[model samples]
Target chain A: MSYKAIQLIKRPSGDLTPDIFATVELPRPVLEEGQFLVRQTHMSLDPAMRTWLQEREDSYIEPVQVGEVMRSYGVGEVVESRNPDYPAGARVIGITGWAEYVLGNADMQVVDPAIDPEALLSVFYMTGLTAYVGLIRIGRPKAGETLVVSGAAGSVGSLVGQIAKAEGMRVVGIAGSDEKCRWLEEELGFDKAINYKSDNLGGQLDEACPNGIDLYYENTGGVIQPLVFERMNRFGRIVVCGMISEYNRDQPTPGPSWVDINLKALRVEGFVVVDHQDKAQEATEALAGYLQNGQLRFRTQVLEGLDSAIDGLSMLFRGDNTGKLLVRI
Target chain B: MSYKAIQLIKRPSGDLTPDIFATVELPRPVLEEGQFLVRQTHMSLDPAMRTWLQEREDSYIEPVQVGEVMRSYGVGEVVESRNPDYPAGARVIGITGWAEYVLGNADMQVVDPAIDPEALLSVFYMTGLTAYVGLIRIGRPKAGETLVVSGAAGSVGSLVGQIAKAEGMRVVGIAGSDEKCRWLEEELGFDKAINYKSDNLGGQLDEACPNGIDLYYENTGGVIQPLVFERMNRFGRIVVCGMISEYNRDQPTPGPSWVDINLKALRVEGFVVVDHQDKAQEATEALAGYLQNGQLRFRTQVLEGLDSAIDGLSMLFRGDNTGKLLVRI
Candidate 1:
């Protein structure tokens, strides 16, 4: 009859704080004709949530308004359905809020019930689609070209580096820690992984990418951005996927000068996965092929309950989560 | 016979000084088997010439050596020819140095002698091609969209605004002086023109582009860059054509943060006209059509003789030129 949900009480200033969100219990909604009820099983916590919390009018998607249940992508099952399209017991994936029970909308897709929810959320959903779209479609990485990805140990970055490697690119990753760097190089098959916290990041990048960076997958926008930007070869492509490092700051860091961008003939593009839903089937098929060949590997850092998502979101900013951050309801 | 030329005696540091160049008389070249002699009548002074003077290894083309003649684009008449492709009295357009006469290379294109040299350099040569490629091809602007062009009075920027207007787009121009702004709005058919040097540039831009900027043709990247960048609408495209404002500096100014780029799904692209030669014919035909329809208008600030070019080059940096800067010998 009732379900617990996290509601955004205050908009974040710099860093996310506990006071910004309030956990509350809400009555389950009665489904009308053509509407279905979904019991959310796993909700993804992403860096993009920071943008959704902002009060900006010009964001790609409408920001989650204050006093509203926080928005997220999740996998759920239809507990009760008035819509024949989503029969009871059918699994679905779509925009589900931080709640145990939600009234599913037309946007929700009925997915195979047999696929593991972790794999569904990690590889076959927004996480995998973002990486595929950013790297393959936007980046257009070529074989023998060098690809440098920031936040290489995180979900999208990890997938991007691995996908670049799968496409026969020389993949170099930049992560926050040496342990993550080792994981990227050894586990993800990256050609080289440099720790951004280490000394002489420019030098490390130079040494790693002797041929210069041809494609740069930008997830983190700290020291790695300018350094990799300077080393980009002529006609390089930079996929501005996420600037996770600058999400909490009031004034984000300035980007590299446009002079080099002009002189080097570089293309810097940004895209959100939701805008490219038409390519979802193609991306999923390609990612599934890679997954079947064992070229794709993913790890999940799951929190216990719905309430955990409030604090779990901050873990992404702090770079605490090892892989995909999710809240298992 | 001897002709006057300007040689880059030393590399410039910040502002270009007259002492950096040495005016000298050189003997006209005798035509070789495949070479032809060109009597350059009108040498174009472009902002891209500043980059040609820099000794960077990664520049789009090879930089002029310290002891070499300053590189430029010019329209000339072939006085003597050994090549069948270029006969004597044939008007040619291509890379020519700051000289009265030079040997023609294979890159030079023989133009119809009937076309005015000023018209060729201003709207049908590299200047026109650069504008056409950057705006139409890269920006992919649609009808009813807003286009804001920095350096709106300059050769390429002026053409870019006119072409956008011809394509049925709302055109806004950013220039340094009020006179140039007036010229843009009145003579060039720009919907609105803002003087970037005036107080409250951001407010002026907001007032000018009520619908927000969709395509930004960046020629000067100083105060106007961040202002236009901040006002870009969702899916906006920024064509980084030239950074004339930052070209003479020891350290170019940093660009706006790329956060908005990612959040709004923006595409920032930079290109050199030389790289897109395949589209030259298409651009020429399109530009010629605009010229025939009286849609494109141009102004030239012509300097007298090759010797004036040494001091005349500084006018571009000072924003002193009314339109396209050219040297008539």
Candidate 2:
């Protein structure tokens, strides 16, 4: 059988586009022992996928090579299975590609059918777990403390703000648009939301966080980082989850302002969820409980087909999506 | 009842100079209800004194006014006492000024008489405790790990290297001079010493630390900072104690490349020794044991008169001090 798949034609410079990615017809693999055939259902579009496309081997994951199937994580439905564990009709997720179908072994991670599939694919699996681990495990935010979250309208930042708020912290968010800022404050229960694109971002942030920022959940890392870095309290903690602001730049982006970190004796740490698979279930249960109790809210923006995956991922860099941007194959 | 003192005549721009300070004769302070007179014997000179000179109100300690006695830590001999805790003939230490005499109460912390006075002034009081707390408490470095210390020839850096070496970590020292580097390697038992003034610092560091740096004791934050910052191993820890290189600058002098901090997932923390005085005796005894056992080596550059205090402090910002810079009253 033949299926269509997206192949990377050339290494990208700033942003991934349709030109660098070409659709190619490939023969479907014949299943072996403990293998299953999965028809692609949903493809996850994330900022980290941008890191995977870099032509460097030193990154957390190996860079995608020219003419290779675009490396991605996705959810699929098992159509045929040789193993009882992954019987036909079961849903699975893993490093599934931007393709119509996948023929793989038990290495296909099973997705729990109990949770909402949209939330599971977008937040609970990776982005939501990243927020949980970074905010609770690493940042260790305290009650009544002030928390400032960057990219507050995006997937990870939105969850991080709600989590901090649920923990009794006074939560403030920084987002790109006034509408996103309004959603963060009004819908997500953020104490305050500052528009990063505004001219008076520094002043608005200073007024919002009067006691100084105790915890900073950093997502977008170029312009807002220095402003928040200066306002951090003595012994503040920073969770460096993403830097979408500088992901497109060819050169190494300078910093998140080390002077404040050193001067205030602050703690700055970056984490990748791929390294912490052990906490996936724990974070999912905690997040699910919050979701069921109506204490947490998540938004997903689904784009149709694998053809839009390249452009969907670019939307993350430009702050185009209001929520978790995904592709429904 | 008269004594001479170093007085600040004007706020300094770059390096402090003798003209900005004038030695003036003044009447000795009279004892209060719970006060005793202390003949200041030794005044401590540290990189932090430069911070006190800043004309700002937001620092850890209150800034010294333009016409006040230079704020410093000093050791004194109790000449007249009104309290048994600080009896006559006893040696005491505290935040005494750059004066020949100090009238103090029980707040005048008494230093143990035996642990070499120079060592007491330099290490036991602030610098040594800073090194111990930062390396052991904050860095939490494990044995068999690699440690790279900046300003390895200076007071705190010297202690940090010996302490890391004692804990079985491979120690690499970075200093400004060949002579200082040799002393760190030959006298202090550092495994490697890289002169930061060398033409190829990155190449030298790469060769010396094949395992990559696991812990960095950052005392000098200038050009060498970014170089070492890039070579940090994953989950590396940086103990930010002082930034002597930028102490003389009128404006913020850029940064030490923070992109490396996030990329490597490093933990960078700065500390004030005064904040950790509770760990003083513990660190002092641990340090003294090493000193008595000949496991550690210390040096003190004693400036002869109070008049040389400006030049001595200036020497620190210029990286001219080869050891613990001090002033003898």
Off by over 4 Å in 1: none
Candidate 2 docking band = medium
- Tell me the docking grade of candidate 1: high
Error of 2 at B259 (Å): 3.9
Per-residue lDDT of model 2, residues B1-329, tens digit only: 79988888888888777688888888987776677988988888898888788765235778888889888888889998877788898889888888888777556787668756787876677887888999999999899999999999999999999988989999999998999998998899999999888898999999999998899888888888888887888788988887877777776666643444545577788777777889988998888787787878889999988777878888887888879988888
Residue pairs with colliding backbones in model 2 are none
**Tens digits of per-residue lDDT for model 1 on A246-282?**
8899988899999998999999998887888888989
Model 1 / residue B296 / CA error / Å:
0.9
- Model 1 DockQ reads 0.87
DockQ for candidate 2, C-alpha atoms: 0.49
